[model samples]
Target: MSRPRTLTDWQALAARLTPQLQGNAFINDDFVPAVSGETFECLNPATGERLAKVASCDGADAEIAVRHARAVFKRGGWSRMAPVERKGVLLRLADLMERHQDELALLDTLDMGKPITSALDDVAGAIGSMRHQAESIDKLYGEVAPTGEQVLGLVLREPLGVVASIVPWNFPLMMTAWKVAPALAAGNSVILKPSEKSPLSALRLAALAREAGLPSGVFQVLPGFGHTVGRALALSMDVECLAFTGSTTVGKQLMQYAGQSNLKRVFLECGGKSPNIVFADCADLDRVAESAAAAIFYNQGEVCIAGSRLLVENSIRDAFVAKVVAAAERMQPGDPLDPTSFMGAMVDSTQHERVMGYIRKGIDEGAVLRAGGEDVAGPGLFIRPVVFDGVTPEMVIGREEIFGPVLSVFGFETEEEALALANDSDFGLAAGLWSQDIGRIMRMTHRLESGQVFVNNWAGGDQSMPFGGVKQSGNGRDKSHHSLAEYTQLKSVWIALS
Candidate 1:
């Protein structure tokens, strides 16, 4: 699909791509609402218009979905399918996603205010993730270990029955694929609860799964608020495992719910206030500045691993700051439907207000508002890229995860001070270091508290690399073969020989 240039073209493209649905949850391969017949409006953040009414699913809906998932698992429908058969279905699903890439992108853009380019990237990522998991499960084998001479020990990986995947609004489609593809590949019945802020993509993905020949009830999407349906799913005794990607606050609550219920295994990829460190010895200041802008401004800075904090070496701080400001100025927030727009609106008015509040807090804390600290002049929930200079670690903006296009700059004199500033944060999901010195790169790689560190680049990796965080940023890895471990259980058996 070619890029839609004008607003008229964009509107026409959206109409062609998106399906007009009567708000309902995708359960057991059918669209239906909550037993109570409750519904909620899904608003277009870009225009603040009601896009559609989605099912306001609650505990009752969760129960029905769980029972359906359990029944399907017990019937040996998807769980007992041959590995090759499962792989074929997933590959077909990926193919379907590729064929309808434009539609998927439009659904995500309309639903969550993500820029069309980024939404398209999410679609590509979802396709790749599904294909990666599907390919991996087919080739992987259980291990046999030698015990004493007369016996053999074998370790087998088994699916954890029914899994509940609750994903965040940001990167809706990608996060869903990150959790669901691996769980489904491991032969588990999956019940997905996508964030109410962005439920369209998940619901559409469920439709594609069924069209790709997945067994009925094998995969389901429940659209509703997090407090009700999300809590119900978390507290369900039948849900064997729960995989989530969201805020640290909600992630902690889900963990407690898991312990209180069936003690279901929980895997989370939560919040981050990641630091991007740039040393004076780094020669590529231009590229560094470009990446720095992209690091914090992409997706309107709603990324969990966004480089919100910048720790720069004092010697080159001024030059780097100027370049970064220029880069940020070039990337303005605009209409999400336009393919040329680098930044888009916030997920909603609530998030927009929250981000503006953070900006005000930064000013109150006495940091210099260097650039783009206010909401854009026009309508919609659009906020310009904000950069704060002379920031102290004690300030709320420096320490907190704003989850917006806000960047805080801190200057340090030495490597020791830089490392200290980077590691002082309560969250450590991801960090970035830019330096030409191999020794500094090697040292920082070992010293940084983050789970993943980018040497020169910022915020990018493929499905092959594992992604997660440490400390308050949550636990467990996503994307790679390691993610399979989250959805599977290990069984060890000893066989006696003659």
Candidate 2:
């Protein structure tokens, strides 16, 4: 479906569909304020305008939500539902999501400052994730282990009771669905705590889940700071499993919380400073350059797996840098509601300041700024696509995950140097290498330390592929059949007949 582009057009659309302007934490199929009864303003980064007041939940709210989810799981209303029945509800939820894509997209755009086009893609991905998990629910099979002649052994996967989903703000609804769908498909009740920067879509999702026949307390949304509700969920004894997608620092803290509390199963998909390499023998330099720019600039570089470090072979270093710089020039800050807007504002003032600090560090480290080093002055929190050359591995910009639209360029003469430079980071979430040589591709594929490597492309994957990272980038997969196992526990049943 087509949507309005201009601000005036969007204002008219908003008047007709005011879409829960103010939202509260969703629990037991209803919306309610926190026990503290405090609220915070959700601002539009594009215009710095107050969109709505969101509930500021704390440890008190977390206690109530966890207990309710535990009760629901014990009651067998949802946890004991047949696989096919659970699949049906998830499918219906996807359908309703499709029906309300416009509203959801707008909410995401307003809440997170993502381009409307990007927000639409996020909604589509969220729907796809739910449907994919739904279809895989009943098809998943248990195992029959070999045993002695008189003994039979069977291994079954069972739900882990209550699960907590803590997702980041970059892909709000999609990330939530990636965790929620698989956990729910495994017959577990979920308590989702979305990033405080963007929690509107999660609240909306809970309402849709209830409408699609999800039993009370099966799915809940808590909107608050990570230190409060998120930490509470991590420390809860009743939450058997916790799935989190956010910063590496917070991921480590959650792991500690799990140990300090009930020692819950923790699955984390954390930060990345992914590398994008370009070889001299590449057939299409223009396409590679365009992809390189898109890789780092897309979504204001808020993506966890963004290719922020660009390594080009010395043979094509100058030419590739020029092409990438020109492409970066085209991505400028624009109104997120406008469909044609290619780039949007940062999520908030704090993130905006953080990106600026990185840009300054790059300049201070003697890296030459090829393009866009300053902020776009206006009512919104917008930064230009900053590209820096002459960056060294020891430089702060090269070593840190700036988490913004800032690219660091490096030149390597040999394949060995490129491999060394790419693997020099503490993160191993993802990496992108562009080379047509089959032997080179094979060599890099084997040697790269990252979890997911993209050959001749940037960060790209579907729900069918397993997605996760290693090392400081964190552990456990997010998508595909492997992810379903994260939420389920294995039980071995042995039978003997004499």
lDDT scores of the candidates, listed in order: 0.92, 0.92
Residue 133 C-alpha lDDT in model 2: 96
* Tens-place lDDT digits, model 1, residues 1-498: 675667678789877655574468988989997888998988888888888888999999999999999999999878988888899999999999999887888888998898988998999999999999999998889998867889989999989999999999999999999999999999999999999999988888888899999998999999998899999999999999999999999999999999999999998898999999999888779989999989999999999999999999899999999999999999899999988899999998889999999999999999999999889765588999999999999999999999999999999999999999999988989999999999889998999999999988987699999999999998999999999999989999998887
**Each candidate's clash count:** 0, 0
Q: How high is the lDDT of residue 136 in model 1?
A: 93
Query: Once superposed on the true structure, which residue ranges of model 2 sit more than 4 Å away at CA?
Result: 1-8
lDDT of 2 by residue, 1-498 (tens): 566667677656756655446578998878999999998888889888888889999999999998999999999988889999999999999999999988888888888888888998999999999999999999999998988889889999999999999999999999999999999999999999999999988988888898999999999999999998998999999999989999999999999999999999999999999999999998799999999999999999999999999999998899899999999988887888777777899999999999999998899899999999998888999888999998999999999999999999999999999999999999999999899999999999989999999998887789999999988999999889889999999999998867
Worst 10 residues of 2 by lDDT: 13-22
TM-scores of the candidates in the order shown:
0.98, 0.98
